[model samples]
Target chain A: MVTVNGEQKNAAGQNLLAFLKTEGYEPERVVVERNLDIVPRDELEKVVLEDEDVVEVLRFVGGG
Target chain B: MEQERKLSKDADPEKDVQEGKSLPDQLQIEDPEEVKKQMQQILSKEELDRAFDARFPKEMQQKFRGARVAIAGLGGLGSNIAVMLARSGIGHLLLVDFDTVDVTNLNRQMYLVPHVGMPKTRAILQILYQVNPYLDYETVQAKVTPENVKELFGGYPIVCEAFDKPDQKAMLVRELLGQCPESTVVSGNGMAGVGDSNGIRTAKFGNRLYVCGDRTTDVGGGVGLTAPRVALCAAHEANKVLQLILQEDS
Candidate 1:
Protein backbone atom coordinates (compact mmCIF):
# COMPACT_ATOMS: atom_id res chain seq x y z
CA MET A 1 0.00 0.00 0.00
CA VAL A 2 1.21 3.50 -0.96
CA THR A 3 -0.04 6.96 -0.08
CA VAL A 4 -1.17 9.49 -2.73
CA ASN A 5 -2.42 12.91 -1.72
CA GLY A 6 -2.79 11.69 1.91
CA GLU A 7 -4.90 8.64 1.02
CA GLN A 8 -3.59 5.08 1.21
CA LYS A 9 -3.98 3.06 -2.00
CA ASN A 10 -2.74 -0.21 -3.41
CA ALA A 11 -0.62 0.04 -6.54
CA ALA A 12 -0.64 -3.82 -6.94
CA GLY A 13 2.50 -3.60 -9.16
CA GLN A 14 0.72 -1.80 -11.99
CA ASN A 15 2.20 1.02 -14.14
CA LEU A 16 1.62 4.62 -13.07
CA LEU A 17 -0.49 5.56 -16.09
CA ALA A 18 -2.98 2.72 -15.55
CA PHE A 19 -3.32 3.57 -11.88
CA LEU A 20 -3.92 7.24 -12.68
CA LYS A 21 -6.50 6.33 -15.29
CA THR A 22 -8.20 4.03 -12.80
CA GLU A 23 -8.19 6.90 -10.31
CA GLY A 24 -9.86 9.17 -12.95
CA TYR A 25 -7.01 11.66 -13.19
CA GLU A 26 -5.69 13.11 -16.46
CA PRO A 27 -1.94 12.88 -17.05
CA GLU A 28 -1.54 15.77 -19.46
CA ARG A 29 -2.99 18.53 -17.30
CA VAL A 30 -1.05 17.40 -14.24
CA VAL A 31 2.68 17.13 -13.48
CA VAL A 32 4.14 14.40 -11.33
CA GLU A 33 7.13 15.08 -9.10
CA ARG A 34 8.39 11.75 -7.86
CA ASN A 35 11.15 11.67 -5.23
CA LEU A 36 12.34 15.23 -5.81
CA ASP A 37 12.72 14.88 -9.61
CA ILE A 38 9.98 16.10 -11.89
CA VAL A 39 8.60 13.37 -14.14
CA PRO A 40 8.45 15.12 -17.48
CA ARG A 41 5.04 15.39 -19.13
CA ASP A 42 6.20 13.26 -22.05
CA GLU A 43 7.31 10.36 -19.88
CA LEU A 44 4.28 10.09 -17.59
CA GLU A 45 3.13 6.78 -19.08
CA LYS A 46 6.54 5.15 -19.38
CA VAL A 47 7.35 5.41 -15.67
CA VAL A 48 6.02 2.67 -13.41
CA LEU A 49 4.91 3.13 -9.82
CA GLU A 50 6.51 1.17 -7.01
CA ASP A 51 5.00 0.22 -3.70
CA GLU A 52 5.05 3.03 -1.10
CA ASP A 53 6.01 5.56 -3.78
CA VAL A 54 5.01 9.13 -3.03
CA VAL A 55 3.59 11.08 -5.95
CA GLU A 56 2.53 14.71 -5.93
CA VAL A 57 0.33 15.79 -8.82
CA LEU A 58 -0.17 19.45 -9.54
CA ARG A 59 -2.49 21.18 -12.04
CA PHE A 60 -2.16 24.52 -13.82
CA VAL A 61 -4.56 27.46 -13.76
CA GLY A 62 -4.85 30.51 -16.02
CA GLY A 63 -3.82 34.02 -14.89
CA GLY A 64 -1.87 37.07 -15.96
CA MET B 1 30.95 79.00 40.63
CA GLU B 2 34.09 81.11 40.03
CA GLN B 3 35.81 79.52 43.02
CA GLU B 4 34.96 75.98 41.76
CA ARG B 5 36.34 76.82 38.34
CA LYS B 6 39.59 78.10 39.87
CA LEU B 7 39.87 74.89 41.96
CA SER B 8 39.48 72.71 38.86
CA LYS B 9 42.08 74.82 37.01
CA ASP B 10 44.52 74.35 39.86
CA ALA B 11 43.91 70.55 40.12
CA ASP B 12 46.74 68.13 39.19
CA PRO B 13 46.74 66.94 35.55
CA GLU B 14 46.82 63.21 36.61
CA LYS B 15 43.96 63.65 39.13
CA ASP B 16 41.87 65.49 36.52
CA VAL B 17 42.39 62.66 34.05
CA GLN B 18 41.35 60.03 36.67
CA GLU B 19 38.21 61.98 37.60
CA GLY B 20 37.29 62.39 33.94
CA LYS B 21 37.45 58.59 33.57
CA SER B 22 34.83 58.23 36.39
CA LEU B 23 32.10 60.13 34.46
CA PRO B 24 30.41 56.79 33.72
CA ASP B 25 30.12 56.20 37.52
CA GLN B 26 28.30 59.51 37.78
CA LEU B 27 25.92 58.31 35.08
CA GLN B 28 25.14 55.14 37.10
CA ILE B 29 24.49 57.28 40.20
CA GLU B 30 21.44 58.85 38.45
CA ASP B 31 20.65 56.31 35.73
CA PRO B 32 16.93 57.13 35.56
CA GLU B 33 17.50 60.83 34.97
CA GLU B 34 20.24 60.02 32.48
CA VAL B 35 17.91 57.65 30.54
CA LYS B 36 15.17 60.30 30.49
CA LYS B 37 17.59 62.86 29.10
CA GLN B 38 18.79 60.39 26.45
CA MET B 39 15.27 59.58 25.39
CA GLN B 40 14.40 63.25 25.08
CA GLN B 41 17.45 63.84 22.88
CA ILE B 42 16.70 60.76 20.73
CA LEU B 43 13.11 61.79 20.02
CA SER B 44 13.67 65.42 19.07
CA LYS B 45 11.67 67.27 16.43
CA GLU B 46 14.24 66.69 13.67
CA GLU B 47 14.36 62.95 14.48
CA LEU B 48 10.58 62.74 14.55
CA ASP B 49 10.38 64.47 11.19
CA ARG B 50 12.79 61.96 9.68
CA ALA B 51 10.87 59.02 11.13
CA PHE B 52 7.55 60.38 9.85
CA ASP B 53 8.96 60.70 6.35
CA ALA B 54 10.24 57.17 6.53
CA ARG B 55 6.97 55.55 7.67
CA PHE B 56 4.11 57.89 6.89
CA PRO B 57 1.65 57.74 3.94
CA LYS B 58 1.21 54.04 4.46
CA GLU B 59 -2.34 54.08 3.05
CA MET B 60 -1.28 55.63 -0.24
CA GLN B 61 1.55 53.10 -0.85
CA GLN B 62 -0.14 49.98 0.50
CA LYS B 63 -1.08 48.48 -2.85
CA PHE B 64 2.35 48.49 -4.49
CA ARG B 65 4.10 47.69 -1.23
CA GLY B 66 2.29 44.37 -0.84
CA ALA B 67 3.03 42.91 -4.26
CA ARG B 68 5.66 40.14 -4.67
CA VAL B 69 6.85 39.49 -8.22
CA ALA B 70 9.55 37.27 -9.71
CA ILE B 71 11.48 37.82 -12.95
CA ALA B 72 12.94 34.65 -14.45
CA GLY B 73 15.62 36.18 -16.65
CA LEU B 74 17.57 39.42 -16.36
CA GLY B 75 18.02 40.08 -20.05
CA GLY B 76 16.38 42.90 -21.99
CA LEU B 77 12.79 42.09 -21.13
CA GLY B 78 13.70 41.04 -17.60
CA SER B 79 15.85 44.12 -17.00
CA ASN B 80 13.11 46.50 -18.13
CA ILE B 81 10.49 44.66 -16.08
CA ALA B 82 12.63 44.90 -12.95
CA VAL B 83 13.35 48.59 -13.46
CA MET B 84 9.72 49.43 -14.15
CA LEU B 85 8.58 47.51 -11.07
CA ALA B 86 11.13 49.27 -8.90
CA ARG B 87 10.18 52.66 -10.30
CA SER B 88 6.47 51.86 -9.88
CA GLY B 89 7.07 51.11 -6.17
CA ILE B 90 6.53 47.39 -6.14
CA GLY B 91 7.52 46.43 -2.62
CA HIS B 92 9.07 43.00 -3.01
CA LEU B 93 10.80 41.43 -6.02
CA LEU B 94 12.66 38.19 -6.64
CA LEU B 95 15.24 38.30 -9.44
CA VAL B 96 16.62 35.01 -10.83
CA ASP B 97 19.53 34.94 -13.26
CA PHE B 98 22.64 32.81 -13.51
CA ASP B 99 24.31 34.57 -16.41
CA THR B 100 27.10 37.08 -16.04
CA VAL B 101 27.07 40.43 -17.81
CA ASP B 102 29.06 40.37 -21.03
CA VAL B 103 30.03 42.97 -23.61
CA THR B 104 27.43 41.56 -25.98
CA ASN B 105 24.68 42.21 -23.41
CA LEU B 106 25.20 45.96 -23.74
CA ASN B 107 23.24 46.07 -26.98
CA ARG B 108 19.85 45.38 -25.42
CA GLN B 109 20.42 44.55 -21.72
CA MET B 110 20.72 48.23 -20.59
CA TYR B 111 23.70 47.30 -18.47
CA LEU B 112 26.68 49.58 -18.06
CA VAL B 113 30.38 48.87 -18.59
CA PRO B 114 31.06 48.59 -14.85
CA HIS B 115 28.58 45.70 -14.69
CA VAL B 116 30.61 43.55 -17.05
CA GLY B 117 31.56 40.15 -15.58
CA MET B 118 29.25 40.74 -12.60
CA PRO B 119 26.42 38.36 -11.87
CA LYS B 120 23.22 39.55 -13.49
CA THR B 121 21.33 39.35 -10.18
CA ARG B 122 23.75 41.68 -8.35
CA ALA B 123 23.90 44.15 -11.22
CA ILE B 124 20.13 44.34 -11.51
CA LEU B 125 19.70 44.62 -7.73
CA GLN B 126 22.20 47.50 -7.49
CA ILE B 127 20.33 49.38 -10.20
CA LEU B 128 17.00 48.66 -8.53
CA TYR B 129 18.24 49.86 -5.14
CA GLN B 130 19.43 53.04 -6.75
CA VAL B 131 16.00 53.48 -8.32
CA ASN B 132 14.00 52.92 -5.08
CA PRO B 133 15.83 52.62 -1.79
CA TYR B 134 12.78 51.17 -0.04
CA LEU B 135 12.22 48.37 -2.54
CA ASP B 136 12.65 44.84 -1.18
CA TYR B 137 14.57 42.39 -3.39
CA GLU B 138 15.86 38.81 -3.36
CA THR B 139 18.39 37.26 -5.72
CA VAL B 140 18.76 33.70 -6.94
CA GLN B 141 22.25 33.49 -8.37
CA ALA B 142 21.77 30.12 -10.05
CA LYS B 143 19.67 28.89 -12.92
CA VAL B 144 16.06 28.06 -12.18
CA THR B 145 15.77 24.30 -12.12
CA PRO B 146 12.88 21.96 -11.55
CA GLU B 147 14.30 21.00 -8.16
CA ASN B 148 14.43 24.58 -6.90
CA VAL B 149 11.54 26.12 -8.81
CA LYS B 150 9.14 25.77 -5.90
CA GLU B 151 11.67 27.22 -3.49
CA LEU B 152 12.34 30.16 -5.80
CA PHE B 153 8.65 30.96 -6.28
CA GLY B 154 7.20 29.93 -2.94
CA GLY B 155 5.88 33.35 -1.87
CA TYR B 156 5.83 35.29 -5.13
CA PRO B 157 2.33 36.02 -6.45
CA ILE B 158 3.47 36.55 -10.06
CA VAL B 159 6.28 35.30 -12.34
CA CYS B 160 7.56 36.84 -15.58
CA GLU B 161 9.06 34.25 -17.92
CA ALA B 162 11.69 36.28 -19.76
CA PHE B 163 14.09 33.42 -20.38
CA ASP B 164 15.78 33.37 -23.80
CA LYS B 165 15.82 29.64 -24.24
CA PRO B 166 12.63 28.04 -25.45
CA ASP B 167 13.12 24.87 -23.39
CA GLN B 168 13.74 26.86 -20.23
CA LYS B 169 10.61 28.93 -20.77
CA ALA B 170 8.52 25.82 -21.41
CA MET B 171 9.87 24.15 -18.30
CA LEU B 172 9.24 27.23 -16.20
CA VAL B 173 5.69 27.52 -17.44
CA ARG B 174 5.09 23.88 -16.62
CA GLU B 175 6.67 24.13 -13.19
CA LEU B 176 4.92 27.36 -12.24
CA LEU B 177 1.48 26.08 -13.17
CA GLY B 178 2.25 22.74 -11.54
CA GLN B 179 3.72 23.96 -8.27
CA CYS B 180 2.22 27.40 -7.80
CA PRO B 181 -1.37 27.06 -8.90
CA GLU B 182 -2.31 30.48 -7.55
CA SER B 183 0.59 32.31 -9.21
CA THR B 184 0.03 34.37 -12.38
CA VAL B 185 2.69 33.41 -14.95
CA VAL B 186 3.29 35.59 -18.00
CA SER B 187 5.32 34.30 -20.95
CA GLY B 188 6.96 36.17 -23.84
CA ASN B 189 7.44 35.00 -27.38
CA GLY B 190 9.16 36.33 -30.56
CA MET B 191 10.36 39.72 -29.32
CA ALA B 192 13.63 39.43 -31.19
CA GLY B 193 14.95 41.88 -33.79
CA VAL B 194 11.50 42.44 -35.23
CA GLY B 195 10.03 45.74 -36.43
CA ASP B 196 6.79 47.48 -35.40
CA SER B 197 4.68 44.58 -36.70
CA ASN B 198 6.56 42.22 -34.36
CA GLY B 199 5.99 44.24 -31.21
CA ILE B 200 3.91 42.95 -28.26
CA ARG B 201 0.54 41.34 -27.70
CA THR B 202 -1.28 40.32 -24.56
CA ALA B 203 -3.46 37.20 -24.75
CA LYS B 204 -5.30 35.55 -21.90
CA PHE B 205 -5.29 31.77 -22.05
CA GLY B 206 -8.30 30.89 -19.94
CA ASN B 207 -7.86 32.78 -16.63
CA ARG B 208 -4.39 31.83 -15.32
CA LEU B 209 -1.67 32.03 -18.00
CA TYR B 210 -1.20 35.31 -19.85
CA VAL B 211 1.18 35.47 -22.85
CA CYS B 212 2.53 38.81 -24.10
CA GLY B 213 4.77 39.12 -27.12
CA ASP B 214 4.80 38.92 -30.91
CA ARG B 215 2.74 35.89 -31.91
CA THR B 216 4.30 35.85 -35.36
CA THR B 217 5.45 32.20 -35.13
CA ASP B 218 9.01 33.20 -36.08
CA VAL B 219 11.01 32.42 -32.92
CA GLY B 220 14.74 31.54 -32.81
CA GLY B 221 15.37 32.00 -36.52
CA GLY B 222 18.52 34.09 -35.91
CA VAL B 223 16.42 37.28 -35.48
CA GLY B 224 18.02 38.91 -32.44
CA LEU B 225 16.00 40.63 -29.75
CA THR B 226 15.94 44.42 -29.87
CA ALA B 227 15.17 47.08 -27.25
CA PRO B 228 11.82 48.27 -28.64
CA ARG B 229 10.21 44.83 -28.96
CA VAL B 230 11.53 43.58 -25.61
CA ALA B 231 10.48 46.73 -23.81
CA LEU B 232 6.98 46.53 -25.23
CA CYS B 233 6.58 42.94 -24.03
CA ALA B 234 7.87 43.87 -20.58
CA ALA B 235 5.44 46.76 -20.33
CA HIS B 236 2.56 44.48 -21.14
CA GLU B 237 3.67 42.02 -18.49
CA ALA B 238 4.08 44.76 -15.91
CA ASN B 239 0.64 46.14 -16.64
CA LYS B 240 -0.83 42.67 -16.27
CA VAL B 241 0.83 42.25 -12.90
CA LEU B 242 -0.47 45.61 -11.72
CA GLN B 243 -3.97 44.76 -12.87
CA LEU B 244 -3.87 41.44 -11.06
CA ILE B 245 -2.81 43.08 -7.79
CA LEU B 246 -5.49 45.76 -8.15
CA GLN B 247 -8.16 43.07 -8.68
CA GLU B 248 -9.16 44.70 -11.97
CA ASP B 249 -10.64 42.06 -14.23
CA SER B 250 -8.45 41.72 -17.33
Candidate 2:
Protein backbone atom coordinates (compact mmCIF):
# COMPACT_ATOMS: atom_id res chain seq x y z
CA MET A 1 0.00 0.00 0.00
CA VAL A 2 1.25 3.46 -0.91
CA THR A 3 -0.08 6.96 -0.25
CA VAL A 4 -0.68 8.99 -3.40
CA ASN A 5 -1.71 12.53 -2.54
CA GLY A 6 -3.05 11.46 0.87
CA GLU A 7 -5.09 8.52 -0.47
CA GLN A 8 -4.02 4.96 0.30
CA LYS A 9 -3.58 2.92 -2.85
CA ASN A 10 -1.70 -0.13 -4.09
CA ALA A 11 1.40 0.97 -6.00
CA ALA A 12 3.97 -1.35 -4.46
CA GLY A 13 5.42 -2.87 -7.66
CA GLN A 14 5.06 -0.04 -10.18
CA ASN A 15 7.54 2.52 -11.46
CA LEU A 16 6.69 6.16 -10.78
CA LEU A 17 6.14 6.88 -14.48
CA ALA A 18 3.71 3.95 -14.97
CA PHE A 19 1.79 4.86 -11.84
CA LEU A 20 1.51 8.49 -13.01
CA LYS A 21 0.22 7.45 -16.45
CA THR A 22 -2.29 5.10 -14.89
CA GLU A 23 -3.43 7.99 -12.74
CA GLY A 24 -3.98 10.09 -15.95
CA TYR A 25 -1.13 12.58 -15.42
CA GLU A 26 0.98 13.50 -18.42
CA PRO A 27 4.64 12.87 -17.76
CA GLU A 28 5.72 16.20 -19.15
CA ARG A 29 3.24 18.43 -17.34
CA VAL A 30 3.52 16.99 -13.85
CA VAL A 31 6.14 17.11 -11.10
CA VAL A 32 6.40 14.11 -8.84
CA GLU A 33 7.58 14.05 -5.25
CA ARG A 34 8.61 10.76 -3.68
CA ASN A 35 8.67 10.62 0.11
CA LEU A 36 8.85 14.41 0.40
CA ASP A 37 11.75 14.73 -2.07
CA ILE A 38 11.36 15.94 -5.64
CA VAL A 39 11.95 13.26 -8.29
CA PRO A 40 13.68 14.82 -11.24
CA ARG A 41 11.79 14.66 -14.53
CA ASP A 42 14.30 12.34 -16.19
CA GLU A 43 14.31 9.90 -13.26
CA LEU A 44 10.59 9.16 -13.23
CA GLU A 45 10.88 6.05 -15.40
CA LYS A 46 13.59 4.52 -13.23
CA VAL A 47 12.27 5.38 -9.76
CA VAL A 48 9.98 2.69 -8.37
CA LEU A 49 7.49 2.81 -5.54
CA GLU A 50 7.56 0.54 -2.49
CA ASP A 51 5.09 -0.33 0.21
CA GLU A 52 4.10 2.70 2.34
CA ASP A 53 5.91 5.04 -0.05
CA VAL A 54 4.41 8.52 -0.33
CA VAL A 55 4.05 10.39 -3.64
CA GLU A 56 2.67 13.75 -4.61
CA VAL A 57 2.05 14.82 -8.21
CA LEU A 58 1.59 18.42 -9.31
CA ARG A 59 1.06 20.07 -12.70
CA PHE A 60 1.38 23.59 -14.03
CA VAL A 61 -1.71 25.54 -15.07
CA GLY A 62 -1.28 28.11 -17.81
CA GLY A 63 -3.46 31.22 -18.27
CA GLY A 64 -2.17 34.52 -16.93
CA MET B 1 7.80 92.06 17.24
CA GLU B 2 9.72 91.77 13.96
CA GLN B 3 8.72 93.91 10.97
CA GLU B 4 7.53 91.97 7.83
CA ARG B 5 9.84 92.40 4.84
CA LYS B 6 8.22 93.41 1.55
CA LEU B 7 8.72 90.87 -1.25
CA SER B 8 10.32 91.99 -4.50
CA LYS B 9 10.20 90.29 -7.92
CA ASP B 10 14.00 89.84 -7.90
CA ALA B 11 14.40 88.47 -4.35
CA ASP B 12 17.50 86.26 -4.03
CA PRO B 13 16.31 82.70 -3.37
CA GLU B 14 19.81 81.84 -2.09
CA LYS B 15 19.55 84.40 0.65
CA ASP B 16 16.65 82.53 2.26
CA VAL B 17 18.65 79.28 2.49
CA GLN B 18 21.57 81.21 4.06
CA GLU B 19 19.12 82.72 6.52
CA GLY B 20 17.47 80.55 9.16
CA LYS B 21 14.17 80.42 7.22
CA SER B 22 12.99 77.97 4.52
CA LEU B 23 12.51 79.31 1.00
CA PRO B 24 8.74 79.05 1.07
CA ASP B 25 8.66 80.78 4.41
CA GLN B 26 10.94 83.49 3.10
CA LEU B 27 8.42 84.25 0.32
CA GLN B 28 6.25 85.86 3.03
CA ILE B 29 3.06 85.89 0.98
CA GLU B 30 -0.55 86.20 2.11
CA ASP B 31 -1.88 85.50 -1.41
CA PRO B 32 -2.36 81.94 -2.66
CA GLU B 33 -0.71 82.80 -6.02
CA GLU B 34 2.53 83.80 -4.29
CA VAL B 35 2.53 80.56 -2.29
CA LYS B 36 2.05 78.49 -5.46
CA LYS B 37 4.86 80.35 -7.16
CA GLN B 38 7.24 79.73 -4.21
CA MET B 39 6.31 76.01 -4.11
CA GLN B 40 7.40 75.44 -7.73
CA GLN B 41 11.05 74.73 -7.01
CA ILE B 42 13.26 71.83 -8.14
CA LEU B 43 13.93 69.05 -5.65
CA SER B 44 17.07 66.96 -5.62
CA LYS B 45 16.87 63.18 -5.96
CA GLU B 46 17.66 62.68 -2.29
CA GLU B 47 14.84 65.01 -1.37
CA LEU B 48 12.53 63.17 -3.78
CA ASP B 49 13.40 59.82 -2.27
CA ARG B 50 12.70 61.10 1.16
CA ALA B 51 9.25 62.13 -0.02
CA PHE B 52 8.67 58.72 -1.63
CA ASP B 53 9.76 56.89 1.49
CA ALA B 54 7.30 58.92 3.55
CA ARG B 55 4.41 56.95 1.99
CA PHE B 56 5.20 53.56 3.52
CA PRO B 57 6.12 52.43 7.02
CA LYS B 58 9.85 52.65 7.63
CA GLU B 59 10.42 48.90 7.97
CA MET B 60 8.57 47.87 4.78
CA GLN B 61 10.20 50.65 2.80
CA GLN B 62 13.61 49.50 3.95
CA LYS B 63 12.93 45.86 3.08
CA PHE B 64 11.84 46.66 -0.50
CA ARG B 65 14.28 49.52 -1.09
CA GLY B 66 17.00 47.65 -2.93
CA ALA B 67 15.65 44.13 -3.32
CA ARG B 68 15.47 42.86 -6.93
CA VAL B 69 12.85 40.68 -8.65
CA ALA B 70 12.57 39.18 -12.14
CA ILE B 71 9.26 38.53 -13.89
CA ALA B 72 9.00 36.23 -16.91
CA GLY B 73 6.12 36.91 -19.33
CA LEU B 74 4.28 40.21 -19.27
CA GLY B 75 0.73 39.18 -19.89
CA GLY B 76 -2.05 39.34 -17.33
CA LEU B 77 -0.09 37.76 -14.50
CA GLY B 78 3.25 39.40 -15.17
CA SER B 79 1.79 42.84 -15.80
CA ASN B 80 -0.17 42.96 -12.57
CA ILE B 81 2.71 41.50 -10.61
CA ALA B 82 5.06 44.09 -12.01
CA VAL B 83 2.73 46.95 -11.09
CA MET B 84 2.24 45.61 -7.57
CA LEU B 85 5.96 45.12 -6.99
CA ALA B 86 6.70 48.57 -8.32
CA ARG B 87 4.06 50.17 -6.14
CA SER B 88 5.60 48.39 -3.16
CA GLY B 89 8.99 49.88 -4.06
CA ILE B 90 10.85 46.65 -4.76
CA GLY B 91 13.48 48.93 -6.42
CA HIS B 92 14.45 46.80 -9.42
CA LEU B 93 12.69 44.48 -11.89
CA LEU B 94 13.80 42.28 -14.78
CA LEU B 95 11.05 41.60 -17.32
CA VAL B 96 11.18 39.22 -20.31
CA ASP B 97 8.66 38.56 -23.06
CA PHE B 98 8.81 37.84 -26.81
CA ASP B 99 5.22 38.51 -27.76
CA THR B 100 3.40 41.67 -28.72
CA VAL B 101 0.12 42.84 -27.30
CA ASP B 102 -2.92 41.78 -29.32
CA VAL B 103 -6.51 42.95 -29.24
CA THR B 104 -7.60 39.65 -27.77
CA ASN B 105 -5.08 40.00 -24.97
CA LEU B 106 -6.60 43.30 -23.92
CA ASN B 107 -9.47 41.43 -22.30
CA ARG B 108 -7.43 40.01 -19.44
CA GLN B 109 -4.01 41.55 -19.98
CA MET B 110 -2.88 44.86 -18.54
CA TYR B 111 -2.71 46.75 -21.76
CA LEU B 112 -4.55 49.54 -23.47
CA VAL B 113 -5.90 49.74 -27.01
CA PRO B 114 -2.95 51.81 -28.17
CA HIS B 115 -0.58 49.09 -27.00
CA VAL B 116 -2.06 46.42 -29.22
CA GLY B 117 0.93 46.35 -31.55
CA MET B 118 3.67 47.08 -29.03
CA PRO B 119 5.87 44.41 -27.55
CA LYS B 120 4.74 43.31 -24.12
CA THR B 121 8.09 44.18 -22.56
CA ARG B 122 7.92 47.79 -23.71
CA ALA B 123 4.30 48.19 -22.75
CA ILE B 124 4.83 46.77 -19.27
CA LEU B 125 7.90 48.94 -18.78
CA GLN B 126 5.93 52.04 -19.68
CA ILE B 127 3.12 51.17 -17.29
CA LEU B 128 5.46 50.19 -14.45
CA TYR B 129 7.51 53.35 -14.70
CA GLN B 130 4.37 55.42 -14.78
CA VAL B 131 3.39 53.72 -11.53
CA ASN B 132 6.79 54.24 -9.91
CA PRO B 133 9.47 56.24 -11.66
CA TYR B 134 12.05 55.26 -9.05
CA LEU B 135 11.88 51.62 -10.16
CA ASP B 136 14.74 50.17 -12.26
CA TYR B 137 13.54 47.94 -15.10
CA GLU B 138 15.62 45.57 -17.24
CA THR B 139 13.50 44.28 -20.09
CA VAL B 140 14.23 41.70 -22.80
CA GLN B 141 12.06 40.87 -25.76
CA ALA B 142 12.92 37.20 -26.15
CA LYS B 143 11.14 33.94 -25.59
CA VAL B 144 12.37 31.87 -22.65
CA THR B 145 13.47 28.38 -23.57
CA PRO B 146 14.93 25.54 -21.51
CA GLU B 147 18.33 26.17 -23.10
CA ASN B 148 18.49 29.87 -22.09
CA VAL B 149 16.36 29.74 -18.94
CA LYS B 150 19.32 29.92 -16.60
CA GLU B 151 21.12 32.60 -18.60
CA LEU B 152 18.06 34.84 -19.02
CA PHE B 153 16.91 34.76 -15.40
CA GLY B 154 20.16 34.35 -13.51
CA GLY B 155 21.33 36.79 -10.81
CA TYR B 156 17.84 37.52 -9.54
CA PRO B 157 16.95 35.88 -6.27
CA ILE B 158 13.30 35.39 -7.24
CA VAL B 159 11.82 34.63 -10.67
CA CYS B 160 8.11 34.90 -11.40
CA GLU B 161 6.44 32.55 -13.91
CA ALA B 162 3.70 34.32 -15.82
CA PHE B 163 3.60 32.47 -19.09
CA ASP B 164 0.23 31.63 -20.68
CA LYS B 165 1.09 28.16 -21.87
CA PRO B 166 1.32 25.04 -19.74
CA ASP B 167 4.32 23.63 -21.56
CA GLN B 168 6.28 26.85 -21.27
CA LYS B 169 5.39 27.22 -17.61
CA ALA B 170 6.37 23.65 -16.87
CA MET B 171 9.59 23.91 -18.83
CA LEU B 172 10.66 27.10 -17.10
CA VAL B 173 9.82 25.77 -13.65
CA ARG B 174 11.64 22.50 -14.28
CA GLU B 175 14.70 24.27 -15.63
CA LEU B 176 14.71 26.97 -12.97
CA LEU B 177 14.41 24.44 -10.19
CA GLY B 178 17.19 22.34 -11.68
CA GLN B 179 19.59 25.21 -12.41
CA CYS B 180 18.87 27.78 -9.71
CA PRO B 181 17.73 25.43 -7.02
CA GLU B 182 18.01 27.98 -4.28
CA SER B 183 15.96 30.79 -5.78
CA THR B 184 12.21 30.98 -5.37
CA VAL B 185 9.89 30.69 -8.39
CA VAL B 186 6.35 32.04 -8.11
CA SER B 187 3.87 30.68 -10.66
CA GLY B 188 0.14 30.68 -11.35
CA ASN B 189 -2.04 27.82 -12.50
CA GLY B 190 -5.82 27.10 -12.61
CA MET B 191 -7.21 30.61 -12.74
CA ALA B 192 -9.83 30.48 -15.44
CA GLY B 193 -13.55 31.36 -15.67
CA VAL B 194 -15.54 33.25 -12.99
CA GLY B 195 -17.08 31.07 -10.33
CA ASP B 196 -15.83 31.48 -6.75
CA SER B 197 -12.94 33.92 -6.78
CA ASN B 198 -11.87 32.41 -3.47
CA GLY B 199 -11.00 29.14 -5.23
CA ILE B 200 -7.67 30.72 -6.22
CA ARG B 201 -4.86 30.20 -3.70
CA THR B 202 -1.15 29.85 -3.20
CA ALA B 203 0.54 26.46 -2.83
CA LYS B 204 4.14 25.90 -1.83
CA PHE B 205 6.18 23.21 -3.54
CA GLY B 206 8.83 22.54 -0.99
CA ASN B 207 10.99 25.65 -0.33
CA ARG B 208 11.81 26.79 -3.84
CA LEU B 209 8.57 26.88 -5.89
CA TYR B 210 5.37 28.72 -5.00
CA VAL B 211 2.32 28.32 -7.26
CA CYS B 212 -0.80 30.46 -7.06
CA GLY B 213 -4.37 30.02 -8.35
CA ASP B 214 -6.93 27.23 -8.43
CA ARG B 215 -4.76 24.23 -9.22
CA THR B 216 -7.61 22.47 -10.99
CA THR B 217 -8.89 25.35 -13.09
CA ASP B 218 -7.73 25.64 -16.69
CA VAL B 219 -8.98 26.63 -20.13
CA GLY B 220 -10.77 23.31 -20.52
CA GLY B 221 -14.36 22.47 -19.45
CA GLY B 222 -15.80 25.18 -21.70
CA VAL B 223 -14.24 27.84 -19.48
CA GLY B 224 -12.55 31.01 -20.68
CA LEU B 225 -10.04 33.31 -19.03
CA THR B 226 -11.17 36.55 -17.43
CA ALA B 227 -9.49 39.45 -15.74
CA PRO B 228 -10.87 39.14 -12.22
CA ARG B 229 -9.60 35.62 -11.60
CA VAL B 230 -6.30 36.17 -13.38
CA ALA B 231 -5.62 39.37 -11.45
CA LEU B 232 -6.44 37.58 -8.21
CA CYS B 233 -3.86 34.94 -9.02
CA ALA B 234 -1.37 37.59 -9.94
CA ALA B 235 -2.08 39.32 -6.66
CA HIS B 236 -1.37 36.12 -4.79
CA GLU B 237 1.94 35.69 -6.62
CA ALA B 238 2.96 39.30 -5.97
CA ASN B 239 1.88 39.13 -2.34
CA LYS B 240 3.74 35.88 -1.84
CA VAL B 241 6.90 37.39 -3.26
CA LEU B 242 6.60 40.24 -0.78
CA GLN B 243 6.08 37.80 2.07
CA LEU B 244 9.11 35.79 1.02
CA ILE B 245 11.30 38.88 0.74
CA LEU B 246 10.22 40.15 4.15
CA GLN B 247 10.60 36.70 5.65
CA GLU B 248 14.27 36.69 4.70
CA ASP B 249 14.96 39.79 6.79
CA SER B 250 13.09 38.44 9.79
Among these predictions, the greatest TM-score belongs to 2
- Candidate 2 structure quality by residue, lDDT tens digits, B109-161: 88877678888887776666556555577899998987788898876789999
Compared with the true structure, what per-residue lDDT tens digits does model 1 show for residues B1-250? 4553334566665554643212233222223234434434434535543554586465434677778889999987788889988766788999999999999888778577878888888788666655565557888888998789898886677898877765566678778877777778887765666567445678775346777876543345556666766788788888887777767332
The collision pairs in model 2 are none
How many residue pairs in model 1 have overlapping backbones?
A: 7
Could you say which candidate leads in DockQ?
2
Error of 1 at A46 (Å): 6.2
Which 10-residue window in model 1 chain B sums to the lowest lDDT? B21-30
Error of 1 at B85 (Å): 0.3
Q: Fraction of reference contacts reproduced per prediction?
A: 0.01, 0.65
Off-target runs (Cα >4 Å) in candidate 1 are A1-40, A43-64, B1-60, B197-199, B217-219, B248-250
lDDT of 2 at A20: 88
In model 2, the runs with Cα more than 4 Å from the true position are: B1-51
Number of the top lDDT candidate? 2
